[model samples]
Target: MSPTQASRPSTGRAARPLAALLLVAGAAHFARPRTFDAIVPRSLPGTPRAWTYASGVAELALGAAVAAPRTRRLGALAAAGFFVAVLPANVKMAADWRHRPTPYKEIAWARVPLQLPLVWWAMRAGRKV
Candidate 1:
Protein backbone atom coordinates (compact mmCIF):
# COMPACT_ATOMS: atom_id res chain seq x y z
CA MET A 1 0.00 0.00 0.00
CA SER A 2 1.07 3.58 -0.57
CA PRO A 3 2.39 5.54 2.44
CA THR A 4 -0.75 7.61 2.65
CA GLN A 5 -2.99 4.59 2.45
CA ALA A 6 -0.99 2.81 5.12
CA SER A 7 -1.27 5.75 7.46
CA ARG A 8 -5.07 5.85 7.21
CA PRO A 9 -7.33 3.69 9.34
CA SER A 10 -7.31 0.13 8.07
CA THR A 11 -10.93 -0.53 8.83
CA GLY A 12 -14.30 1.21 8.43
CA ARG A 13 -15.17 0.53 12.07
CA ALA A 14 -14.01 4.01 13.06
CA ALA A 15 -17.06 5.60 11.48
CA ARG A 16 -19.68 3.14 12.68
CA PRO A 17 -20.46 5.00 15.90
CA LEU A 18 -20.72 8.28 14.10
CA ALA A 19 -23.14 6.74 11.63
CA ALA A 20 -25.24 5.28 14.44
CA LEU A 21 -25.28 8.62 16.22
CA LEU A 22 -26.54 10.33 13.10
CA LEU A 23 -29.27 7.75 12.65
CA VAL A 24 -30.50 7.96 16.26
CA ALA A 25 -30.33 11.75 16.31
CA GLY A 26 -32.18 11.91 13.01
CA ALA A 27 -34.91 9.64 14.29
CA ALA A 28 -35.35 11.75 17.40
CA HIS A 29 -36.31 14.68 15.21
CA PHE A 30 -39.40 12.86 14.04
CA ALA A 31 -39.99 11.21 17.37
CA ARG A 32 -40.34 14.51 19.22
CA PRO A 33 -40.41 17.32 16.73
CA ARG A 34 -41.81 19.67 19.33
CA THR A 35 -38.74 19.42 21.50
CA PHE A 36 -36.56 20.35 18.57
CA ASP A 37 -38.88 23.17 17.56
CA ALA A 38 -38.50 24.81 20.94
CA ILE A 39 -34.85 25.46 20.22
CA VAL A 40 -35.20 26.63 16.63
CA PRO A 41 -34.00 30.17 17.19
CA ARG A 42 -36.49 32.95 16.43
CA SER A 43 -33.97 34.76 14.27
CA LEU A 44 -34.48 32.17 11.55
CA PRO A 45 -37.36 32.48 9.13
CA GLY A 46 -40.05 29.84 8.70
CA THR A 47 -41.66 27.95 11.53
CA PRO A 48 -39.30 26.23 13.91
CA ARG A 49 -41.18 23.00 13.32
CA ALA A 50 -40.39 23.08 9.64
CA TRP A 51 -36.71 23.56 10.28
CA THR A 52 -36.73 20.66 12.73
CA TYR A 53 -38.20 18.26 10.22
CA ALA A 54 -35.90 19.45 7.46
CA SER A 55 -32.85 18.91 9.61
CA GLY A 56 -34.14 15.51 10.62
CA VAL A 57 -34.50 14.50 6.99
CA ALA A 58 -30.99 15.68 6.28
CA GLU A 59 -29.68 13.70 9.21
CA LEU A 60 -31.39 10.50 8.08
CA ALA A 61 -30.01 10.90 4.61
CA LEU A 62 -26.52 11.60 5.87
CA GLY A 63 -26.65 8.68 8.28
CA ALA A 64 -27.69 6.26 5.57
CA ALA A 65 -25.09 7.58 3.16
CA VAL A 66 -22.28 7.42 5.65
CA ALA A 67 -23.17 3.89 6.69
CA ALA A 68 -22.52 2.65 3.18
CA PRO A 69 -18.88 2.35 2.24
CA ARG A 70 -19.47 3.61 -1.30
CA THR A 71 -20.87 6.91 -0.08
CA ARG A 72 -18.92 7.36 3.13
CA ARG A 73 -16.71 10.21 1.96
CA LEU A 74 -19.49 12.40 0.68
CA GLY A 75 -21.68 11.49 3.62
CA ALA A 76 -18.97 12.41 6.07
CA LEU A 77 -18.55 15.81 4.45
CA ALA A 78 -22.30 16.30 4.53
CA ALA A 79 -22.31 15.22 8.16
CA ALA A 80 -19.81 17.94 8.99
CA GLY A 81 -21.95 20.48 7.16
CA PHE A 82 -25.06 19.30 8.92
CA PHE A 83 -23.35 19.62 12.29
CA VAL A 84 -22.38 23.19 11.48
CA ALA A 85 -25.72 24.05 9.92
CA VAL A 86 -27.47 23.16 13.17
CA LEU A 87 -25.21 25.17 15.44
CA PRO A 88 -27.72 27.98 15.71
CA ALA A 89 -30.34 25.64 17.09
CA ASN A 90 -27.91 24.45 19.74
CA VAL A 91 -27.22 28.04 20.67
CA LYS A 92 -30.90 28.75 20.98
CA MET A 93 -31.30 25.64 23.14
CA ALA A 94 -28.59 26.85 25.45
CA ALA A 95 -30.14 30.27 25.81
CA ASP A 96 -33.69 29.09 26.26
CA TRP A 97 -32.73 26.52 28.85
CA ARG A 98 -30.82 29.01 30.97
CA HIS A 99 -33.68 29.39 33.42
CA ARG A 100 -34.55 25.70 33.46
CA PRO A 101 -33.83 23.37 36.40
CA THR A 102 -30.30 22.51 37.52
CA PRO A 103 -29.21 19.43 35.58
CA TYR A 104 -31.52 20.26 32.72
CA LYS A 105 -30.07 23.74 32.45
CA GLU A 106 -26.51 22.48 32.54
CA ILE A 107 -27.30 19.76 30.04
CA ALA A 108 -28.71 22.26 27.58
CA TRP A 109 -25.78 24.62 27.94
CA ALA A 110 -23.31 21.77 27.59
CA ARG A 111 -24.60 21.05 24.10
CA VAL A 112 -23.20 24.40 22.97
CA PRO A 113 -19.51 23.62 23.32
CA LEU A 114 -20.23 19.99 22.49
CA GLN A 115 -20.48 21.03 18.87
CA LEU A 116 -16.76 21.47 18.63
CA PRO A 117 -16.07 17.83 19.52
CA LEU A 118 -18.81 16.71 17.18
CA VAL A 119 -17.31 18.71 14.36
CA TRP A 120 -13.93 17.17 14.97
CA TRP A 121 -15.49 13.70 14.97
CA ALA A 122 -17.18 14.46 11.66
CA MET A 123 -13.89 15.58 10.16
CA ARG A 124 -12.26 12.37 11.27
CA ALA A 125 -15.04 10.27 9.82
CA GLY A 126 -14.76 12.21 6.59
CA ARG A 127 -11.05 11.67 6.33
CA LYS A 128 -11.41 7.95 6.99
CA VAL A 129 -13.88 7.29 4.21
Candidate 2:
Protein backbone atom coordinates (compact mmCIF):
# COMPACT_ATOMS: atom_id res chain seq x y z
CA MET A 1 0.00 0.00 0.00
CA SER A 2 1.05 3.58 -0.49
CA PRO A 3 2.35 5.50 2.54
CA THR A 4 -0.78 7.67 2.63
CA GLN A 5 -3.08 4.65 2.48
CA ALA A 6 -1.13 2.88 5.23
CA SER A 7 -1.32 5.90 7.48
CA ARG A 8 -5.09 6.21 7.18
CA PRO A 9 -7.59 3.93 8.89
CA SER A 10 -9.86 1.74 6.78
CA THR A 11 -13.20 3.41 6.07
CA GLY A 12 -15.22 0.96 8.11
CA ARG A 13 -12.89 1.07 11.06
CA ALA A 14 -12.62 4.83 11.06
CA ALA A 15 -16.37 5.38 10.86
CA ARG A 16 -17.62 2.76 13.29
CA PRO A 17 -16.85 4.54 16.52
CA LEU A 18 -18.40 7.76 15.28
CA ALA A 19 -21.42 5.89 14.01
CA ALA A 20 -21.81 4.14 17.32
CA LEU A 21 -21.50 7.39 19.23
CA LEU A 22 -24.21 9.02 17.12
CA LEU A 23 -26.46 6.00 17.39
CA VAL A 24 -26.19 5.78 21.15
CA ALA A 25 -26.62 9.50 21.62
CA GLY A 26 -29.63 9.42 19.28
CA ALA A 27 -31.17 6.63 21.29
CA ALA A 28 -30.58 8.53 24.48
CA HIS A 29 -32.69 11.37 23.13
CA PHE A 30 -35.63 8.99 23.12
CA ALA A 31 -34.84 6.97 26.22
CA ARG A 32 -34.13 9.99 28.38
CA PRO A 33 -35.45 12.79 26.25
CA ARG A 34 -35.90 15.22 29.09
CA THR A 35 -32.15 15.36 29.59
CA PHE A 36 -31.68 16.46 26.01
CA ASP A 37 -34.65 18.77 26.15
CA ALA A 38 -33.16 20.57 29.08
CA ILE A 39 -30.18 21.63 27.01
CA VAL A 40 -32.12 23.01 24.04
CA PRO A 41 -31.61 26.73 23.82
CA ARG A 42 -34.71 28.59 24.92
CA SER A 43 -34.36 31.13 22.16
CA LEU A 44 -35.20 28.61 19.48
CA PRO A 45 -38.67 28.46 18.04
CA GLY A 46 -41.06 25.74 19.25
CA THR A 47 -40.69 23.58 22.33
CA PRO A 48 -37.44 22.12 23.59
CA ARG A 49 -38.87 18.63 23.14
CA ALA A 50 -39.36 19.28 19.44
CA TRP A 51 -35.75 20.26 18.99
CA THR A 52 -34.61 17.28 21.00
CA TYR A 53 -36.59 14.82 18.94
CA ALA A 54 -35.54 16.42 15.67
CA SER A 55 -31.88 16.28 16.58
CA GLY A 56 -32.30 12.67 17.67
CA VAL A 57 -33.73 11.77 14.31
CA ALA A 58 -30.94 13.60 12.54
CA GLU A 59 -28.36 11.74 14.59
CA LEU A 60 -29.92 8.38 13.82
CA ALA A 61 -30.05 9.11 10.10
CA LEU A 62 -26.48 10.38 10.09
CA GLY A 63 -25.31 7.36 12.04
CA ALA A 64 -26.95 5.01 9.58
CA ALA A 65 -25.40 6.86 6.67
CA VAL A 66 -21.95 6.86 8.23
CA ALA A 67 -22.12 3.14 8.92
CA ALA A 68 -22.44 2.39 5.23
CA PRO A 69 -19.34 2.69 3.06
CA ARG A 70 -21.26 4.25 0.19
CA THR A 71 -22.47 7.13 2.29
CA ARG A 72 -19.66 7.59 4.79
CA ARG A 73 -18.18 10.69 3.23
CA LEU A 74 -21.41 12.61 3.09
CA GLY A 75 -22.46 11.40 6.50
CA ALA A 76 -19.21 12.37 8.11
CA LEU A 77 -19.30 15.78 6.49
CA ALA A 78 -22.81 16.29 7.78
CA ALA A 79 -21.74 15.07 11.18
CA ALA A 80 -19.06 17.73 11.31
CA GLY A 81 -21.70 20.37 10.66
CA PHE A 82 -23.94 18.71 13.21
CA PHE A 83 -21.29 19.02 15.88
CA VAL A 84 -20.89 22.69 15.11
CA ALA A 85 -24.64 23.24 15.09
CA VAL A 86 -25.00 21.73 18.54
CA LEU A 87 -22.53 24.03 20.21
CA PRO A 88 -25.25 26.44 21.23
CA ALA A 89 -27.02 23.70 23.15
CA ASN A 90 -23.81 22.80 24.92
CA VAL A 91 -23.26 26.43 25.82
CA LYS A 92 -26.80 26.64 27.11
CA MET A 93 -26.17 23.54 29.19
CA ALA A 94 -23.07 25.06 30.72
CA ALA A 95 -24.84 28.29 31.47
CA ASP A 96 -27.88 26.61 32.95
CA TRP A 97 -25.83 24.25 35.08
CA ARG A 98 -23.50 26.90 36.42
CA HIS A 99 -25.26 26.90 39.77
CA ARG A 100 -25.28 23.14 40.12
CA PRO A 101 -22.82 21.11 42.23
CA THR A 102 -19.21 20.82 41.13
CA PRO A 103 -19.32 17.56 39.22
CA TYR A 104 -22.43 18.43 37.30
CA LYS A 105 -21.13 21.90 36.50
CA GLU A 106 -17.82 20.48 35.34
CA ILE A 107 -19.49 18.02 33.01
CA ALA A 108 -21.68 20.71 31.50
CA TRP A 109 -18.72 22.99 30.95
CA ALA A 110 -16.61 20.19 29.54
CA ARG A 111 -19.22 19.39 26.91
CA VAL A 112 -18.76 22.82 25.35
CA PRO A 113 -15.11 22.26 24.52
CA LEU A 114 -15.60 18.60 23.66
CA GLN A 115 -17.42 19.52 20.44
CA LEU A 116 -14.15 20.60 18.86
CA PRO A 117 -12.75 17.07 18.88
CA LEU A 118 -16.02 15.65 17.69
CA VAL A 119 -16.00 18.05 14.75
CA TRP A 120 -12.41 17.09 13.96
CA TRP A 121 -13.17 13.40 14.20
CA ALA A 122 -16.05 13.70 11.77
CA MET A 123 -13.95 15.69 9.32
CA ARG A 124 -11.16 13.11 9.52
CA ALA A 125 -13.60 10.27 9.05
CA GLY A 126 -14.96 11.97 5.94
CA ARG A 127 -11.50 12.24 4.43
CA LYS A 128 -10.78 8.57 5.06
CA VAL A 129 -12.76 7.73 1.97
Candidate 3:
Protein backbone atom coordinates (compact mmCIF):
# COMPACT_ATOMS: atom_id res chain seq x y z
CA MET A 1 0.00 0.00 0.00
CA SER A 2 1.05 3.61 -0.54
CA PRO A 3 2.67 5.35 2.44
CA THR A 4 -0.29 7.64 2.90
CA GLN A 5 -2.75 4.73 2.76
CA ALA A 6 -0.63 2.65 5.12
CA SER A 7 -0.39 5.46 7.62
CA ARG A 8 -4.11 6.03 7.69
CA PRO A 9 -5.99 4.31 10.49
CA SER A 10 -7.90 1.18 9.67
CA THR A 11 -11.18 2.24 8.08
CA GLY A 12 -13.46 3.68 10.81
CA ARG A 13 -11.30 2.30 13.64
CA ALA A 14 -9.82 5.58 14.82
CA ALA A 15 -13.17 7.31 14.57
CA ARG A 16 -15.32 4.69 16.30
CA PRO A 17 -14.61 5.59 19.93
CA LEU A 18 -15.11 9.27 19.27
CA ALA A 19 -18.24 8.56 17.31
CA ALA A 20 -19.64 6.38 20.11
CA LEU A 21 -18.89 9.02 22.68
CA LEU A 22 -20.70 11.68 20.69
CA LEU A 23 -23.62 9.39 20.02
CA VAL A 24 -24.06 8.52 23.69
CA ALA A 25 -23.65 12.11 24.82
CA GLY A 26 -26.09 13.26 22.17
CA ALA A 27 -28.64 10.71 23.30
CA ALA A 28 -28.19 11.82 26.88
CA HIS A 29 -29.17 15.36 25.99
CA PHE A 30 -32.51 14.16 24.81
CA ALA A 31 -32.91 11.49 27.42
CA ARG A 32 -32.14 13.75 30.34
CA PRO A 33 -32.34 17.15 28.80
CA ARG A 34 -32.83 19.07 32.02
CA THR A 35 -29.33 18.05 33.09
CA PHE A 36 -27.86 19.50 29.94
CA ASP A 37 -30.13 22.55 30.04
CA ALA A 38 -28.83 23.49 33.46
CA ILE A 39 -25.29 23.83 32.12
CA VAL A 40 -26.11 26.15 29.21
CA PRO A 41 -24.28 29.41 29.66
CA ARG A 42 -26.75 32.11 30.67
CA SER A 43 -24.99 34.53 28.31
CA LEU A 44 -26.07 32.61 25.24
CA PRO A 45 -29.11 33.85 23.36
CA GLY A 46 -32.48 32.05 23.62
CA THR A 47 -33.71 29.51 26.14
CA PRO A 48 -31.42 26.90 27.66
CA ARG A 49 -33.58 24.11 26.36
CA ALA A 50 -33.13 25.37 22.84
CA TRP A 51 -29.39 25.34 23.12
CA THR A 52 -29.49 21.93 24.74
CA TYR A 53 -31.47 20.36 21.96
CA ALA A 54 -29.47 22.06 19.26
CA SER A 55 -26.21 20.81 20.68
CA GLY A 56 -27.70 17.36 21.02
CA VAL A 57 -28.65 17.37 17.36
CA ALA A 58 -25.23 18.57 16.38
CA GLU A 59 -23.61 15.80 18.38
CA LEU A 60 -25.76 13.14 16.79
CA ALA A 61 -24.97 14.41 13.32
CA LEU A 62 -21.28 14.69 14.05
CA GLY A 63 -21.24 11.16 15.44
CA ALA A 64 -22.83 9.82 12.29
CA ALA A 65 -20.39 11.71 10.13
CA VAL A 66 -17.42 10.47 12.06
CA ALA A 67 -18.59 6.89 11.85
CA ALA A 68 -18.40 6.89 8.08
CA PRO A 69 -14.91 6.50 6.70
CA ARG A 70 -15.54 8.90 3.84
CA THR A 71 -16.57 11.68 6.19
CA ARG A 72 -14.29 10.92 9.16
CA ARG A 73 -11.72 13.62 8.38
CA LEU A 74 -14.13 16.54 8.35
CA GLY A 75 -16.24 15.03 11.09
CA ALA A 76 -13.29 14.63 13.46
CA LEU A 77 -12.14 18.18 12.73
CA ALA A 78 -15.60 19.52 13.49
CA ALA A 79 -15.73 17.42 16.66
CA ALA A 80 -12.53 19.09 17.84
CA GLY A 81 -14.09 22.48 17.30
CA PHE A 82 -17.22 21.32 19.06
CA PHE A 83 -15.16 20.30 22.09
CA VAL A 84 -13.65 23.77 22.24
CA ALA A 85 -17.00 25.44 21.69
CA VAL A 86 -18.54 23.75 24.72
CA LEU A 87 -15.92 24.96 27.15
CA PRO A 88 -18.11 27.86 28.17
CA ALA A 89 -20.86 25.58 29.28
CA ASN A 90 -18.43 23.51 31.31
CA VAL A 91 -17.09 26.66 32.85
CA LYS A 92 -20.57 27.79 33.66
CA MET A 93 -21.22 24.48 35.33
CA ALA A 94 -18.06 24.75 37.34
CA ALA A 95 -18.89 28.26 38.45
CA ASP A 96 -22.45 27.40 39.26
CA TRP A 97 -21.46 24.33 41.22
CA ARG A 98 -18.74 26.06 43.17
CA HIS A 99 -20.98 26.47 46.22
CA ARG A 100 -22.17 22.91 46.14
CA PRO A 101 -20.64 20.00 48.02
CA THR A 102 -16.98 19.30 47.38
CA PRO A 103 -17.58 16.18 45.29
CA TYR A 104 -20.07 17.91 43.06
CA LYS A 105 -17.86 20.93 42.65
CA GLU A 106 -14.86 18.80 41.86
CA ILE A 107 -16.77 16.86 39.25
CA ALA A 108 -17.91 20.02 37.57
CA TRP A 109 -14.41 21.45 37.65
CA ALA A 110 -12.96 18.24 36.26
CA ARG A 111 -15.14 18.49 33.19
CA VAL A 112 -13.48 21.75 32.21
CA PRO A 113 -10.06 20.19 31.74
CA LEU A 114 -11.50 17.02 30.26
CA GLN A 115 -12.26 18.92 27.10
CA LEU A 116 -8.59 19.19 26.25
CA PRO A 117 -8.11 15.44 25.89
CA LEU A 118 -11.29 15.21 23.90
CA VAL A 119 -10.07 17.89 21.52
CA TRP A 120 -6.76 16.12 21.18
CA TRP A 121 -8.48 12.81 20.48
CA ALA A 122 -10.63 14.39 17.80
CA MET A 123 -7.65 16.01 16.14
CA ARG A 124 -5.68 12.78 16.22
CA ALA A 125 -8.62 10.89 14.80
CA GLY A 126 -8.90 13.40 11.98
CA ARG A 127 -5.23 13.09 11.18
CA LYS A 128 -5.46 9.31 11.13
CA VAL A 129 -8.21 9.60 8.60
Query: Per-residue lDDT of 1-129 in model 2, one digit per residue for the tens?
Result: 999888777767768999999999999899999999999998999999999999999999999988888899999999999999999999999999999999999999999999999998888777753
Question: In model 1, which regions exceed 4 Å deviation?
Answer: 1-11
Scored by TM-score, the top model is: 2
Quote the lDDT for 52 in model 2. 94
lDDT for each residue of candidate 3 in 12-83, tens digit (9 for 90 to 100): 666799999999999999999999999998889999999999999999999998888888989999999999
Candidate 1: C-alpha RMSD after superposition: 1.9
Q: Which ten residues in a row have the lowest lDDT in candidate 2?
A: 120-129
Candidate 3 whole-model C-alpha lDDT, 0 to 1? 0.92
Q: Summarize candidate 1's per-residue lDDT along 1-129 as a digit string, tens digits.
A: 788887778436656888899999999999999999998889888998998899899989998987888888889888988888888888888888889899998898889788888877777876752
* Candidate 3 segments whose C-alpha is farther than 4 A from its true place: 2-11
Off by over 4 Å in 2: none
TM-score of 1: 0.89
Residue 64 of candidate 3: its Cα lDDT? 95
